[model samples]
Target: PGFDPAARPPAPPPAAAPPTAVEPEVTGGGSRLPLLLGGIALVLVAALVGVGWILLKQGGGAAAAGTGVLIVGGSPTGAKVVVNGTPAGELPYVDSSALVGSYEVRVEADGYEPYTQRVVVAPGETAKVTVALKPAAKATAKVLVVSEPLDAKVLLDGEVVKEGGPAPWQASDVEAGKEHEIVVQKPGYRDARFVWTPEPGEEKTFTARLAPALVRLRVESEPAGATVYLDGAKRGRTPLDLEQVDATKQHRLEIDGGRCYERWSSTLIFDERAERTVRATLERSPACATRGDRAPGKKRSSGTAPAPRPKRRGKGKLMLNMRGAWANVWIDGKDTGKQTPLINYELPAGTHRIELKLPDGRSTQLTVEIQPNETVKKTVPAP
Candidate 1:
């Protein structure tokens, strides 16, 4: 058996030479166990990093856990809320991320009393505040008015108050915390106006001083009975007294003398409240003396010499004093160009028919005899 080894049934092809195992190739003299371990560690590290990024993006860090929430609600829904002396928000408000602390809460609304409270907030807990507001009480004030000059009328809010009374007037039950107009007025004085707002339940006294707006003026002339004019307007005859004249400005005073004297004028300013007088002296003017002269171009009649004229007679003075009415005087059926109260008028000595003619078409006739160089005073009655 030992000699025929090649032919001994081929020996089952040498037992088919069992399958051989092949090992993986390793570089740098390193083993695969260490590499596998490194790969597992890298995968674990990447998974951990991804988890950390997701947590940071969701705002779930340490800071978010310490904060609290706050909510405010009240009867008046729109009331303002102040926390710790700082404005927080309006009523029915919610603050999701408020810091945990103690706060002084104040709720306020118009026409309502303010509500105040103390509140505390805890971590991860919500603090809710509820308030019931009450209506505020209305207030009134009393005002006393005093004017410089007594007996001045007082007006409040464009309506007369305490009329027909003196100063130191009082007005009660005026609304407080609102603006009111006060006016003080009197005759012959400038009006005084003021705006006042009083506190609740306050009694206040106000003083108003008024300035005089008119001046008392008396006008006189050297000769009585002259016409007086003020600011180109006829005021009256001379020796006139005016109670109310415009003050603090310049005024023109004029005196006119008819047919005998020159006109007098003056510019005057009255600034004081006292009485003032204006006197004007008229000058005699010769221009009015030739008023009855003939025209310059008229010539005398061409005739023989006229007979000698009779001697001129002496003149007697007539004083006409009229009572209750002023009338025109007519002598011998001719107009005398004079009115009643004509003092010391000269006329020739003779018996003349005197007629008193009134403005209303009424007349009275009398027979008057004038004596030479003597004045006849007659008191004429109104017809």
Candidate 2:
């Protein structure tokens, strides 16, 4: 009855312990899944709060640096807008990003009185301006100037009126109750000036009578018949009378009496409507006796002097009728002692020089051939 260690018939393998169900471990709070999820949610909330704070700070900074807006609108659209003396743009102007400041605004248009105002702009705020324009008053006073000489220039208050054209000129917009100077001018004539004050709505007419600016120049040399020159142009023989010389200007007068006499020169000036006489005494040069030229008034016998033509023997009639103005008549360099409208005046049957002299020192000349016993008619034009 001894027990063998390998024998004992594997005593029933100790009942193969029953399979047991595993139970989850429990903390005092709850499962660990819920705590882990709660921790993650807290982390997410903190991140969201940090992002919101950063966004708020950035938005506040942006608001501090914002600009103002300036908008201008008005009647009379398309009118010019000026800000602080600088041209901004047309009316209905808008500046969205304008620096906030005080500005002087002005609006101007044709035929309208200017509108001006001052405005202040604040940051992030709009400054709005509205302008209503008023029309300018029309001038009712006028001045009419008529000049005696057509095409004369007219000047008012030192400014040319009716520029680029003639006078019979009219000036509108003349201020009432104000004295204005009117000047009418033309070349070769004296200027006419007038001062007048016009009444409101009054159209006053002024007449300007201009006078001729001419001088009567008579030049004579000692031994007459010497050549005379005025301002470098030949004016004929000495004892010359020039009626159309310009007044108030210096004129160069030169007298050359052949090669036998010394030349003389002088400067002459005359006033308007003045009669001036220039007398020059020429000296004979010693070479006059030694010159080999022909003697004075003695013609060289060149084939008997070509036999002078016979003068006509019969008389002829001449009638002169002047138009517009009367002038003194001269026949053959002799004064006729009569004005124009000479009917059937008797003259020699030959070519005669007829001169008409006006009162204003203006003259014209004509040559007429008279036929024997026939009347010659001539119409003299006004000077």
Per TM-score, the best of the predicted structures is 1
Residue-by-residue lDDT tens digits, candidate 1, 187-212? 87878888999899999988887767
The local lDDT score (0 to 100) that residue 337 gets in candidate 2 is 96
Q: Taking the tens digit of each residue's C-alpha lDDT, what string does model 2 give over 208-229?
A: 7776677788877766778889
Query: Could you give the C-alpha RMSD of every candidate to the true structure, in order shown?
Result: 22.8, 22.6
TM-score, prediction 2: 0.34
List lDDT for all candidates, in order.
0.73, 0.75
In model 2, state the lDDT of residue 363.
Answer: 56
lDDT score of residue 334 within candidate 2: 96
Query: How far out, in Å, is residue 90 in model 2?
Result: 7.8
Query: Model 1 lDDT vs. the true structure?
Result: 0.73
Q: What is the TM-score of each candidate against the true structure?
A: 0.39, 0.34
